[model samples]
Target: MHPSTLMMGYGYEPRLSEGALKPPIFLTSTYAFESAADGKRFFEGITGKRPGGSEGLVYGRFNGPNQEILEDRLAQWERAEEALSFSSGMSAIGTALMAHVQPGDVIVHSAPLYAATEKMIDAVFGKFGVKWVDFPAHASPAEIEETIERAKGLGRVSVIYLESPANPTNDLVDIEAVSALRDRMFADAEHRPVIMCDNTFLGPCFQAPTQNGADMSVYSLTKYVGGHSDLVAGAVVGTRDALAPILALRNTLGTITDPNTAWMLLRSLETVQLRMEKAESNARAVATFLKDHPKVERVSWLGFLDPSSSQGEIFKRHCSGAGSTFSVIVKGGEPEAFRLLDNLKTVKLAVSLGGTESLASHPAAMTHLSVPEARRAELGIGDNLVRVSIGVEHEDDLVADFEQALKAV
Candidate 1:
């Protein structure tokens, strides 16, 4: 069956809990075991002393009725062997990076990453002596190879990280090329690098990084997966080997999402396909309107990508859909961007994306400001760039809002 069809009840059984059609929220901190033997086995699994083999819940941090069901549904959607949830997007990313990265290791990352992620790698992880190296979003395959080589010179390049349809810029990164680069750079089995792709933008719906050889695919479930702005959550989906360490770190750090959030995610997962499809359609209309507006200088949207463009071919090959988020560079800088933003009546001027409601924010000052000014400029994100997360709003109404906002600008 199609994913949308499966989303309705893929991982849940109606009779599993009190014959209720929907899964109930298991709100307790821990679950009861059948006996002392069962408790010992569950504890052993939680602490990695033994394999529970999907028998029952252990601890709130390891597994729960709500979290287990949600992970099963999501893992199936992502075509992953296992999935893990976290408190927030950053937590998931941090746990994944920290699990594989260690002191004296290097991470080769793509440009225009989320400011929080950049700060985590540079400030937080750097204290532990982990090195950060940036690779151009538009770099040729050969150039990417060289970038990996340069990082290897500093130390062992343990991870190749990428944020495709990058935050703020809506740029594309070649997952297959990256996988190739990882293989070529770390052909030596002992020094191999794991490829991790931030699939938040395209997601388990529009794009699957693991299909292109990514070791792990991460998402800020707070966005499309949650589909509502009320919750904060993140997810990691990959093979058990690649995901086990991340899951272990999540347990130790207590970064797991609560039962309520997990239940909400399960609810949201059911409608993700419908919501994303509608949002993508709305985005196409919005991007086209922004492109023709005199006040808009440029638009970085997957919908408007040309086949002739360098990144265009990669976009065509990797992405089944041009996700719902895109950025517009106004003719003037921050002032004009703000003018348009302030004048909008339908869309809220806020951070975060991929919810049912439209949201807009300035990348330079909002999401990516923590990135150094020099690095921000080098990545081409200016004060003029305004990122818009297209929601389920009517395309005509959204276009009207943009029309009025552009007039004000």
Candidate 2:
């Protein structure tokens, strides 16, 4: 069945909880065992001590009915063998990377990452004796090969991380090309680095990284997956083998999303496709308007990519649609960008994206402020750049909002 169809009822049974059509939130912290033997069996199953049947829940941190149901549905959507949920997107990413890398291991990642993620890799991980190297998201296949070779010279490459339709810039990394490069470089090695992709920008509806050879696909469910901007959650979906260690780490870190948030995600999944479709349509209209506006200097939207470009070819090969998030460069610098953002009536000046309501934010001063000015410029995140996340609003209303805001600029 189609993912949209499965969202309505998959992995859920109405008869299990007093005939409730919607699954009731299991708010308990622990589950009661039928017998001492049953408790032992559950523990054994979780610990992989014994293979058995009728294994039931042990604790909320370990497992819950709501978490299980949501994980199952998310796995199905991504065509992954298993799925795990986390308290936040960084928790999922940090735990997954930590699970795979040792103290001396190296991580090769794409540049222009989310500010928090970049800080974690370049600063926190470095202090712990792990090393990292970065390649541009638009790096050619040859450039990627050189980056990997350089990292290999430093230490063992344990992971290759990528974020496509990269945060605030709409830059894309070719998943298949990177995966093939990893395979060829590590053909004879005993341990091969895992390829992980952050799919939050495009969401599950727009792209599936697992289909393009990613060992894992990570998401900030707080974004498009939650849709209403009311919940915060994260998810990692991939093969059961690839996820086992990450799940163990998540369990130890106690980063599982609460039952209530899991329930909210379940509700959001049902309408995600519909919400994304409308937002994509609205974004195309808004981007087109920005491209033609006299006050706009440049628009960085995937839908506007030149078909003859390499990034465009990779996007056509891997993605189903150009998602709603993109960045616009205003004609002037910080002062003018602030004027436009401050004058926007319909679109809120905010940091987060992929919500139901339109949002506009200045990356240099807001989301990526921690990044140095030189690095920001290299990533095309300038003082005049405003990241816009189109919502499910009518196209005309959204365009009118931008029109008036540009007038202020």
After superposition, the stretches of candidate 1 with alpha carbons farther than 4 Å from their true spots are 51-54
Instruction: Give the Cα lDDT of each candidate.
Output: 0.87, 0.91
Estimate, for each residue in 1-409, the C-alpha lDDT of model 2 and write its tens digit.
9999999989999998899999999999999998999898888877767643227888888889999899989988778888999999999999998899888889999988999999988898888788988999999999999999999999889999999978878889989999999999999998899999999999789999999989999999999999888888999999888888887777678899999999999999999999999999999999999998989999998998888899999989988999899999999899999999999999999988889999999999998999999999998888999999999989999999999877878
- How does candidate 1 score on lDDT? 0.87
lDDT (tens digit, per residue) of candidate 1 on 47-139: 778763436787777778888888887787668898888899999999999999989899999887888988999999899999988887777
**lDDT, residue 205, model 2:** 94
Quote the lDDT for 243 in model 2: 86
TM-score per model over all chains: 0.97, 0.98
Q: Give every collision pair in model 2.
A: none
Q: Could you tell me the lDDT of residue 329 within candidate 2?
A: 92
